[model samples]
Target: MTAPLQGKIAYVTGGSRGIGRASAIAFAEAGADVAICHLDDEAEARTLVQAVTARGRRGFQMAADMGEVAQINAFTAAAEAALGPCDILLNNAGMNIRNPFGEITEAEFDRMVAVHLKGMFFMAQAVYPGMVARGGGRIINIASQLALKGSPGIVTYCAVKAGIIGFTRALAHEAGPRGVLVNAIAPGPVETDLTRARGPEWKARISASLPLGRIGQPEEISATAVLLAGPGGSFYTGACLSPNGGDVMH
Candidate 1:
């Protein structure tokens, strides 16, 4: 098979499981070395690392909470040391605390902001220089349909995701001349730990309402990430791809 990402280094945050894990494996399958970050899921990260290696690519994992600036910086450095300069960055790390807007505490709201919005910005900043030095690279941010349509009890989550889209567009403009492609993926109801946390019954009800009548799979989302990371995405930048089973039609 032709290696689209051969000789490249790809780093994915929160890759121990869910969309992050799927994207990391997809990048590896395309022939890129992978560096994955998991806050406290080293064991699962190890399994993912082994899987990436098994695909005939190099894989490394680091433990770091993306919500913390210090940890993110350290994680990036560790990944660089292990995987060389990053050629593709998948900013898949994010968290959402569901609660009525009136019940959202300052600290809880802050955590959501720190992890989803703040982390993506700072993480991009940390990796942009390397990508520019290399002449070109891809930065794929995982957003949500809620960010577009908004959702109850997830106000802060939606806010952060909306911020991600804005950030992607702005950063795309800034990074374009430098050869860095910045884009965001707004996935709909998907079957993952994140959705499970939302409640299984609620997950089903949401999926049933979708045109596709089914929740998305991690692998399905991973395919999109592959396109954004490979030659197929050469012309795509500053765009948000909605893989939400036709839920949020334009």
Candidate 2:
């Protein structure tokens, strides 16, 4: 049986761990070559590369800070050179600082925006032209459930995620006519390193509050990305798919 994404190339940011890592593996399992970027974890990134290659798919990895535009451009160029033009772009690189509204520092706010909103926007811009030239492609932005329903301590995080949704919608409108599909995934609380950093107590509270009574797994979210990038997702554009354990239902 032929895989859905055979012969395709995918670029994923923050692919060393968590959701990004799962998405990269999912793409590779679907028969796509992958190129990924991480902030500083060379060892973890190498492991991901190995995993992709183990699936009989080509893989490339680089150390990149998504907050920097020049670094993003450089990563894109290098990935394209190594794996071919990216057919699926996953803007999943991000970080968060949980602080109350009054306690939030300027630097923290800027960093969150830069990494999530700005990085996602320009990364899409960098790949969009090539996607257009290729006649079609998929761009998936990782948003959050907090973007739909505001959170108390992570104001900046919610703001930036909301911005991602807006960007996804507008980009989809502009790109859809040209055969490119742009969408966003708003995931709920997941058992990621970032969430785990919030401590077991916080995780317990969140899990109890969720409709599913537990935090989601990275592979669960990755499955959604696979759907969006594969042939099954041809008709979806400008859509926000939420796999939030029914945390915030619309």
Candidate 3:
């Protein structure tokens, strides 16, 4: 009956919906107070806050772009102010522009770097010092299976995700000994606004190609996060846990 994350505080980026939202609620259900940041989903963010409160957990939400350092810092300060110092950070805010290699624009490339690389890098920096000072914490970055296995038409996305894998592993070395654990989850095609935009044909085709004969759900991916952020994940650091329906086995 004891909650694994009881008395812990979790800060999640892009948590208004999908895997981030699911994990925020899951953390609360496991007894952690959650604070989330969204780009422009006040309605969804409000709904998520209410859901967390419904479960008798403190919830806080802020609207900010993860790509902007000023916004990331402000959001972090606000979240900690609302729920106390963060014990877990989910750098899950992300976006992708699925343009062909030849058609990828400078603007598009810049945005992807800003959101995925810079966003995650600074967000982790923001909370890591606090976590280490407190003697232990969790940092879970959302990566993609495509990072390991090459994919066409989303070259930039794949490149940046691969960068995340590198970042997670490198950070674990510096933070692990300091009592902060860093890891990543490289998920397969999942049901999200981004994936659904690919249409049913693409979905069905991709599903048939997977070893599991199906794509993944947000909760399924979030479950990996729950394990990483909970007591069970204490021994794991610098590890990449893939729940990608056997898309890329390692």
Candidate 4:
């Protein structure tokens, strides 16, 4: 049987760990060659590349911080050189610093906006022309459930994530005409380094409040991403799929 993504090329940001790592592996397993970028953590990136290669698919890794436009362009160039034009682009690189609204500094807020909102916008811009030329492609941005329902101590995070959704929608309108589907994935509390950084108490409290009674796994999130990037997502664009354990039901 042919894989849904056979012969495709995928590019994933923040691919060193967590949802990004899992999604890259999943794409490879589905028969797509993958190129992933990380801010740092060469070891984790190497492991991801190995895992994808082990799946009998080509894998490439680059160290690039998404917060910088030049770095994003460089990473995309490297990916194209190594793997070819991207069929699926996953803008998942992000960071967070939690502090009370009054305590959060200007720099901290700027950092969050740069990484989440600015990065997502330009990354999409970088790949869009190629996608248009190819006649079709997929762009998936990783948002958060907090974007839908505000959270204490992370106002900047919430704002930027919300911006991601807006960006996805607007970009989808422009790109969809050119055969590029743009979407966002808003996940709830997941057992990733980012979420675990909130500490055990936060995790426990969140889990108790969630309908699933537990934080989600990276694999679960990755499955949703794979579906978005594969043939199954042919008709999906400008949609925000929230796999948030029922945290925010609309």
**What total of clashing residue pairs does each candidate reach?**
0, 0, 0, 0
Error of 4 at 144 (Å): 0.7
lDDT of 4 by residue, 1-250 (tens): 9999999999999998999999999999999999999988899999999999999999999999888999999999999999999999999999988899999998998889999989988988899889999899999999998899998988888999999999999989988889999999999889998878879998999899999899999999999999999989989999999998999998
lDDT of each: 0.91, 0.95, 0.94, 0.93
How well does candidate 3 match the true structure in TM-score terms? Answer: 0.98
How far in Å is the alpha carbon of 19 misplaced in model 4? 0.4
Once fitted onto the true fold, the runs of candidate 4 whose alpha carbons sit more than 4 angstroms away are none
Q: Candidate 2, residues 32-88: lDDT per residue as tens digits? A: 999999999999999999999999999999998999999999999999899899899
lDDT score for residue 13 of model 1: 94
- How far does residue 202 in candidate 2 sit from its true spot (Å)? 1.7
Best by lDDT: 2
Where model 1 places Cα greater than 4 Å from the true spot, the runs are none
